[model samples]
Each structure stands twice: as structure tokens, then as C-alpha cells.
Target: MSKKVMFLAHEGVGLGHIARTCKIANHLSEKNMCLVVTGSREAAWLLKRSVDFVKLPSLDGLITERARYLGTKLYFDRGDEKAIRFRKTLAEETARHFAPDIIFIDHTFTGKGGEYKDLLLRSGSEIFIVLRPVLGTREESVRHIFGNLGADLIPVLQPKVLVAGDARTSTSSDDVRSFFPTIPIEHVGYLAGPGERTNPSARPYNILCSSGSGFDGEVLSYAMCELAEKQPDISITLIVGPRGSNPPAAPPNVEVILETHSIHQQLERAQLVVCHGGYNSVIEAMSHHLPIVVFLGDGVDPIARDERRIHSRLLSSHYPLLVCEDVKELPQAIHSSRELPAADTYPNALVVNGLANIGNLVATASPAKASDFVVTPIDRTGDG
Candidate 1:
């Protein structure tokens, strides 16, 4: 019988979680049935062509850096009892009807107050996969709180894999084993795979930046304007993803592409990528061997913490990627990064082989037995 995989993603804040989930779903879709359940209509829309998606209406809370609730920083609205109830009902209904063999959950531990957990545990013998980025201390504290909640709400639950995107950056397998001792940890490499390679001769300089609507776009707009002023000769391509975050009025030197599907092609020829530290964009930059300057935004989502941590670690490892906390410093970072050599890019073969291994593991294992599968991290040569 064919395996059924359900991807449960919380679209409360940024597009990173759902975007990563979509990539995994696309990879797994060739052999298994994939269904994506998300709260962000924009995320669903962005991913609709690649995978099957179901949109769950969200509480529509604006995320700010200073917000907090229940000792956790609020990425989305925390106290919408009615929306939570409605989402919970919908999740339960979906799980009950679909009866998936495995469920992949992104960032959200409780699924709006233990709703999906309740359904999965009661259903029995279903594999749960938790996808997360490698986090630092502050974010780990928040994850611990959510993990505690999951343990309390569903005692029997054990995730089959805690897929970390930063596995390539980890010092050792112990780095991952330390956090998820009960379940196996897999370093799935960067979530963004090899996209279409563009002709290198096409553009002298291509700058790709995306903030999925709201405040992120505003910040990116400011950063892009700064870059355009400093480097007037470079050709700038700004892609605004479907959240309708318009780019600021650009100087004649810059060309803004709104909601463009050709980002992969653009990134292929770009000398530099200026982005909001989103998972998909950052990895896409790395996959294409482009130097990146990431601007960390203070959004109301825990996923932003993941972005910041990933960027911080990348900087520490001298990965040739720079993070701009102050948008004013973007141009300088870009200039400095331009001087550095491109970091060692992961081979396409490695990514394909790794993902194929994951699919094979999922296919061969029984739902209840999947949790025991361990993934050995791929060894990449070079310091960066």
C-alpha cells in the first residue's frame, strides 16, 4: 500500500515553515500522497501548484518583536480562543478522515493547543515528524516550553525524526542528539534544492530580496533603497512574494519584480542576495553558490528566531554570509561579501542522494517503526 504523509504547518507568521514543508512534500510526493494543512492562505497559494494544500483560517494577529504571551514570545496571536477552537476542530476532522500514516509538523508543537497531537495519539501507530532549524539558547528555551506542552498533552507521542536544516553546520551528531534524545535527528541539509541554473553572463549583478508582505517588506524596501544608492551601477532585481509587500519606489538602477516565479533563475546569475533571512531564500542562495547578506527582522513569530539563529551560526562559521541587524549597514556588508570567495557549495548529487535516502527510509518502515530510523549526517569538505 502507498504511504500517506500529512504536513501540518502553522502559517501564523512568516512563510519559512510552510515553505520548507512544501519542499519536503514535493520531494516525498513522487512515492507517497502528500497533503499540506496550513493557516496562511498566502502560503497555501504559493505552494498550491507544487503540493496538495488545505487552508485553515487564522486569527490574523499582527506579529511584533515586543509581543509575548504565556512566557513565550508571540509570533502570531496567542489568545484567540475562538480561532483556536475552530482550527482545532478542523485539524481533528482532517486527520480523522485522512488517517495518514505519517505527519510532518513544522515549528508548531501543539498545533493550536494540542489539537493535532490529540488526534494522532488517539488514532494510534502514526508516525510524527518534527521539522526545525538548529537553534541557540533563547530559542531552545522556547522550544523546550512547547516540547513540554506536547509531552504533557500527549504522553505517548514520539516524533520519528527531528529534521534540522542546519545539520551541515553542526559540530557533531551529538549536537543534535543532545536535544532530541528520544527520537532520531536528521540533518536534511538546506531545504532549498538545486533550482534552474541561469546563464552567468545574463546580469552583471543581481540582488534578490523577499519579505512576505507586512513589516518585513518595509524593512527590505529600506535595505534595497540603501543598496541602490550606494551601488548605482549594479542591476537590482527585487522579488516581492505573494503577500503583496510592495517594494519602495526604486531608483532607475534597480528593477523590481513583483510576485515573480523566476526567483531561482534570478538567483542563479546574481552576485549577491539580500534577503530577510527566510529559510527558502537563504538556502536557495547557498544552493546556487551565491554570497548572501541577510537582514534579520523582528517579526512576531518564533520562526524569525530560527532565521536569526541560522544566520548567527552561519556568520560564526565564516560561511561568507553576512547578517545585517541594522539595515543601514547592508551596503557595507554587501561590499565586504563581494570581496570574499564563494563558500563551498553542497553538490547536487549529495542533496539528491540524501533526500532519496529519506524517502526510502519512510517508504520501507512501518508507521510505528519509523521513529527508530537514524540518519547519519553528510560530511561536507571545507571549513565554510
Candidate 2:
């Protein structure tokens, strides 16, 4: 029997979460029918053809930036009221029409006191699963509150499984297990994999750096210029995602491509990757067995700290990933990463097994069986 699955991805933030969800949905779609509901028009457009999508209200601009800044400090203000109502209505409508066998929520905790929480709780018999990144700590008290809300709401919402998409070494999973021990933790390895192409342009020594919409281009350009001055022989390709508002000019040896689909293609032949410590970029580079030079920009955002933490862990693991704090150090980092021998350290089998497990779990768990699940709140007070 074809199990009906709905994947809910929130928008107005970096494309990481949505991109990860899409990858999972694409894989799952092979065995079952999958639907993606997202608030990001850009992500929806990017994924519309590959997967079924339900577009919600667009929450673009600084609001998305603010959410990234605050981390778990998710608060519902007047602006959120309309979003809340819309999400609830949409959730209900989706449930009524799709009659999904299972519901998977990416990143967002739907069962907590939010509008979606009420809808999920009221949905009656559907198995609501929370698909999250490896767990981590947040600076906000509200995050704890919401964590508790999520923990409590899970039983009420009756999720048959909890899927944690991250490596075993991932701190995010540690945090999740610590908070919600009762919830079964299924570790799906890193969501990123070898993209569509294995061959990029034939360039002897080309570096690829990606700054998803939020990064300061001036800072990146300056750093790239410094690297170019030191390694004149190396060509660099800087990709500013489609939504990059202000891109800076690059040095002569460097090419700045705005919103190009050639990223994966480029990654195939690149000698090294210099990018923000986004999970997708790092994992994709690893998938291609390319060394990475991660720039953890400490801009006004909570994600900065998160990125720094993730990079720190990766560096500690001796994964040929160099973390650069200031632009002054970027040149050295790039040089160091390029010099390292190419090796594939990414765990490809782990990801495949996890996906298979999740598919089987979804297929076996009855949407009508609500009594087989347990939920608990994640304690926010603990020092993660």
C-alpha cells in the first residue's frame, strides 16, 4: 500500500531546512506519495516540479533574519497572529484533503502552543512526526518553554516516530535526547549527498564560496581578494544565492555568479569549497570528497553561534574543514584546505539506512493508532 506522507517546511529563512526536507521527500517519494507544505515561495518554486508543495503566506525580509537571530526565542507577535491562523487553517485543510498516513515536520515544533499545535492536536488520528536536525541549545527561555510545549504536545498530537537527521557526532541529537528521552531517536546521517552532477568545469585550482542571501558581501569580497593576492594561480567562483541583495565585486581571478544552478556542477571540479558553515554546503562538499574552508561570520544572528559550534565540532573531528573567524585568516584557511589530500569522510551508508528505516517506520505505523506513542518536553534549563 502506498503510504501518504506530508512534509511541512517553514520558509523565510535560509534554504537549508527546506533543502534538507526536499532531499528527504525526494527519497521517500520513491516509495510513497509525499507532499511538502512550505512558506517560502523561492523554495517552493525551486522544488515545485520535484515534489508536491503547498504554499503558505510568504514571510520574507528582515522577519526571517530576525528569526535566525533569535534562534529558539520564537515568540508570536501580532505579525505572527495572521501566520498562526493561516497555518492552522492550512493544516486542517491539508489533513482533510490529503488524509495522510503520516505527517513530518521539518525543524518547526508543531505541537507546542502555536496555531499548528492546536491543529495537530485536533487532527485526531494522523501520526505526526517531528523531523529535526541534531539537537542543540538556544539562548532564549522561550525556547525551553516551547521545547516543553513540543514535548507535551507530541503525545497529544500522537507522533509514531521522531527522526533526527544528523551525524552520530552531532550535538543537536545530543540535545534532543537529553530533553526528550522518552521519544525514540532515529539517527539519520547528514541530509546532504552528492548532487545531480559529478563533473564540474575543468579548472585546475578553482575555489567555490557560497553566501546564502544574508552574508555581508563586502566582507566576503575582501577576504576573497586577499586569498587571490596570495594564491594568484587559483581561480575562485563566488556564488551569492538567488536572493542576495547586495553583492560586492570580485577580483580579476575570481568570478562572481549570482543565483546560478551551476553550484553542484561547479562543486564537482572545484579544488576546494569556501562557504558559510551551512549544513548543506559542508555536507555537499564532503559528499564530493572536497576539502572545505568554512567562514563562521559573527553577524547579528543566532545562527552565527550555531554555525560556529557546528564548525568547531567538524574541525575537532579532523575532517579537512578549516574554520575562519576574521577575513584576515581566510587566505590561510583556504590555502590549508586546498593543500589537504582529497578524501571522502562523509557517511553515505548511514544516510541510506536511516532513510530506509524512516520509510519502513512510516509504512508500518498506523495513522489511526494513537496510543502507541509517548511525548515529553525538552528541558531548556540544562546547560547544553
Candidate 3:
């Protein structure tokens, strides 16, 4: 029956990857065997205690701006070779021992800079790439310089099928086909609970500032806090991720939550959501049909710009969004959205019940043909 499933989630630089990985794991039928391995320090928080979860060394350190610059310096010089090697070895060992029937890699095609590429090739299990609802196509310099060429170096370059955790209407298959043209895709909906009724009258705050991980929104946080301080009458709730916790004083109207497991509760209570434009964040906000303002970043991180920009094009009259480039323009967007009527809530926009859909896709899905598996030597050092 090939019921065993193994999920390899990239190290927790952001909450979206691990969060969506575990969400799918939790929904799988109880009869199936499932194992998840992740590098985020928040691994325990990411998955339920019942699921078999292994925590590995985080690879976030190696995927930063500094690591992208490939000049006279060696690959090891750009990244923490120690951490990268350790994670690769641990992941390989874990997957080898588990001997899964199928493998699900969430977002990171090149795990720890091509760590999983070797593992994916050697493992007998069929592998699938789990993509977020919206896979950003905007290429960064690093993607152009290394992303395309690097895929060729990986042995099992193609996934058996791509499972998208978003509704088909929210994102077109064409968006991702450009990335993996031949691979088939299954839309399993946004990996979250259903949308709640919008009670603008009952909303806890007029402006809700949310993000995936606490890691990335320092400048946004500071600016939001400054905005709140400037405008005390307008209420704001910041659902700070692991990185952006510990905001300034509450100032009566402003509230800061350290981190929450499910953002649905807070999202339903928000009249306007100012978020980091993560796939999960945008989908959740849109599900609630609230006015949205997406934050790209402070220009320090390249990923901020290209990663979230692709979905901005999907914003339509039915789902109007205020794309915030800088904090200076945020207050104006918030004010403008406040005047606009609450957008129509499409509760069924995404497939909320995913276990059956995902199970059917994984169980009956065909493994790639023999030609798909090309022989390639393992890059044990993880430098390549």
C-alpha cells in the first residue's frame, strides 16, 4: 500500500515552511505512517507531540544575503559549513532509516543548499515537492545566478507530483508549471481552518499587524509601534512571530502577542490586516475577507521583495489589497482600506478539508519513470 510518508521541512527561517508541513502531516489519515524532520528551533512548536518529529540543525544561517555572494571566497566561507554539513548528515540518516514510501519536501528544493538533493536521489521512496499556495516567480539575482544551474546538478531533479496547499482559483497551475513544467499538481487548499465571520463592529482592533516568524519584521515592527504611538486612537494588534516579539509598551490601544498557533482567531477579529505577505498570511487574511496590506520588507533582505511579490498580481476588485512598500506609506494604506467596504468572504475559496484530497493524491499517484532518476554522485560536503 506504500502508506509510509516522510516530510523534510527546511530549517525555520520563516514560519510558513514548517507550519504548512506540519499542517499537512496532522491531516493525513491515522492509518498512514508519517514522519517529519525540521531544522527550525521551533520544531516542537511546529508539529504535534503525537507525530514523529526530529529536530535538526537550522540552515537559515547559510541562506542569507552574505552566503549568496560567490566571489573569490569559497562556498564554505560564505556559509556555516559546520551547520550545513551536520544538517545534511542528520537528514540523510533520518530519511534512510525511516525508509518512507513517499517523501514530501516543503518549499526548499535545495535543502541546506542542496543537502536533500542527494538524499532524494538515493531514497527509493517516491518524492513530491510541497509548494505554498502561491509560488513566487520573481527571480532574485541569486536565483538567476545559481538557482537554475543548481537544479541540474541535483540527481532526482523532478518531483513525482507537486502538492499545492492553496485553492486552484487563488493560484493558477500555470504559475508553478513554469518552474516544474512536466510535474503534475494537486491543490489541497490552504493548510488552515475555515474563515470566521467578519464583525467589523466586533473586531478587537482596527489594524492588525501580523507576520509568519518573529525573525524578519524588526523595521516594520519599529515603524508600526511608532505609528501606534503617533495615532493612539486607532487600535492595532501585532501578532508578532518568533522573531519580532517584545514590542514597545501597549499604549492602551496597541497589543502584542508573542506567537499564536492558529492565526484564524485573531484574523477574524481584524478589520484590516498588515502582514509580511507570506503565503499562509495572505491566504488566511483573504479567507476572512478583510482589507489587507502586505509588507515586503525594509530592503535589507532580497527574499522579502521577490518571494511575496508574485501573489500581489492576484489581488483583484473582489480581493483588493494595499501593497505597502515602506512603513512610511502604511498608515495611509490603513486609512484608505478602512474606508473601503469589507471584501466578500469566500469560505470555500480553498480546500479546507485536505486529508482525503492529499491522501488520494499520494496513494494513487504514479512514481516517476525510470528515466526521471538520473545517476549523480552525492555531494557529501554540502558545499556544492
lDDT winner among the candidates? 3
Clashing pairs in 3: 214-241, 214-242, 214-243, 214-244, 215-243
lDDT of 2: 0.60
Worst 10 residues of 2 by lDDT: 374-383
lDDT of each: 0.60, 0.60, 0.64
Query: lDDT tens string, model 2, 1-384?
Result: 677777777553567667766767877788778888777665554553547888765444213445665343434444554545545566667755676667777665662225456545654445544444433344342253246356677545545444444454455545554555665556655555545333433555888877765445446655776677677788888777765543454567877776764367778768778877776676677667667777766552465456456645644354667777777778777767656643544333335244556666767766543442222232234222
Q: Give the TM-score of candidate 2.
A: 0.79
Which ranges of candidate 3 are over 4 A from the true structure? 29-31, 60-83, 133-150, 153-158, 161-180, 186-188, 203-205, 230-233, 317-320, 339-356, 366-384
Model 2 lDDT, residue 52, Cα = 86
Q: Tens digit of lDDT per residue, candidate 1, span 239-318?
A: 76555455547788777666764466677768777777665666777667677777765552554555465545554354
Candidate 2 ranges with C-alpha deviation above 4 Å: 48-50, 61-79, 111-113, 124-148, 158-167, 195-202, 215-218, 315-318, 345-357, 367-384
* lDDT value, residue 41 of candidate 2: 64
lDDT of 2 at 284: 74
Expressed as tens digits, the lDDT of each residue in 228-264 for candidate 3 is: 8888777788777766667656566777887887667
**How many residue pairs clash in each candidate at the backbone level?**
2, 5, 5
Write down the TM-score of every candidate. 0.78, 0.79, 0.77
